[model samples]
Target: MRVKKDTSISLFYDMVELMERLRGKDGCPWDKEQNHVTLKPYLVEETYEVIDAIDSGIPDKLKEELADLFLQIIFHCQIAREKKEFDINDVMKLCLDKMMRRHPHVFGDSTASTSEEVVQQWEAIKKQEKGYEERKSAVDGLPKHLPALQKAQKVQKKAAKVGFDWKDINDVIAKVEEEMEEVKEAIAKKETKDMEEEIGDLLFSVVNLSRFLQFDTENILHKTIYKFVDRFKKIEKELASCGKDIEQCSIEELDALWNKVKMNARKNI
Candidate 1:
């Protein structure tokens, strides 16, 4: 199913008008009092809800959550317009201009027969646009706020594009084993900082291996975490039925219960 598309630019303006009305005299007390700083958390929350809807594969919920996200955007734009800074129109124009500049194969004589060539051309054009001096690092374009695994994957992909990567998956696997050995040594020595560093290196190498194998490290980790949560909750409910708390349970008992739940889950799957 398709969402009711915001087909006209006027829709954005209308949303802005609504935000202004809500913030006007005798309007919503909560909306009237919110500023960009105050609304930041809601923006982040709405974004995650949109991501959740997409992950759950619910088109109707996705559309609703997306509209909430757009509302946040419009709210922010309305606030900025009041300060004479920028508005939704400026945001739209900037995006349009950036896309036009980035797609040389579409708007210019440049042609790329493959996605890899397109990426290389895009990076080259980006560097030319920024004049190189502004970006001192090859991975500088990556967002710092990205989840750690995704950020690591992005950094590795960027470096690989510039030929600064392992020759094969075997090399990455070897590096991971080396990092694991360091982690084990650090653990044996009870060196907390060293152990942490080595563990991070191991995880980063795993992300690199996932990239080489054409797997999404983020999705893999997310699914694993979800499974752990589900199985743990089942164990919790089972223990509750037995009138035994987790803290009071022996390690062996907990282990047995966990394995039972896991095996049952796998059988169902």
Candidate 2:
């Protein structure tokens, strides 16, 4: 599986050629069998790996993950080339055209004094170019597969841009409290369906509150999950030191160990 290096070609072009070879008849069976649909999960997985590397604060890891993500792009382009659909050049050309068209402030006569103005102008241009004019709502552009929290934030932002949001931060806080009360009432009724709906409403209101406070719900939730995992592992370590297993511990014992773990964490902080 050796590729002849061509010094005159750009690195990106070489990579694309390498991908074509991998999908060729003489290449790896696994690579040759993958289509865009079958490779979708790898595309998503590599994207998150890139984000994780960035979060890890490792430049080398980030670079490696980015290359993995780029390989997915090349993989798809090679598949498209095989089917005589389109190729890498067409992909780059369309991307370049899209960027040029979207940035009228830089490429055209349109003037934007601020980032917000630039974003507004870009959205307007995107709507016109992407057939969004036929859509009934501004929030129609978000993908259905987007995470629930991120979807909430995007739709809320779209609506807020058109002044369909709470008047102030206090209003958002009040709405969250109202939702919480409804959730409590639903719990008292003990109906599963009502409880589920109320819980969702409460979560949505909390996402709104986070948005109003200029915090991303998705990111904050990720941080909280990491914290939980770290602290729980510490509790497990303490139990192991005492020759005890977590599953053998009572609820009260676990609660005490959790408190000790939190105390130790605070001390370290």
TM-score for all models, in order of appearance: 0.88, 0.93
lDDT score of residue 49 within candidate 1: 96
Across 1-269, the per-residue lDDT of candidate 2 in tens digits comes to 56556653578888988988888879899998889999988988998899899999999999999999989998998898889999988999999999999998899999999988999898788778856777788777888888899999988999898888888988998999999999999999999999999999999999999998889999999999999999899999889999999999999999998998889889988
Cα error, residue 112 of model 2, in Å, equals 2.0
Model 2: number of backbone collisions: 0
**Lowest-sum lDDT 10-residue window in model 1:** 1-10
Q: Give model 2's TM-score versus the native structure.
A: 0.93
The segments of candidate 1 whose C-alpha lies over 4 angstroms from its true place after superposition are 1-7, 130-133
Which model scores highest in lDDT? 2
lDDT of 1: 0.88
Per-residue error for 40 in candidate 1, Å, reads 2.6
Model 1 lDDT tens row, 1-269: 56456655567667778888987887799987788999988988998899889999999999999999999988898888888999888999988988988888999888988998988888787787745667888777777668788899999988988799888788889988999999999999999999999999889888988999989999898899999999999999999998889999999999999999989998998
Supply the TM-score for candidate 1: 0.88
Q: How big is the RMSD of model 1? A: 2.5
- Tell me how far the alpha carbon of residue 69 in candidate 2 is from the true structure, in angstroms, after superposition: 0.2
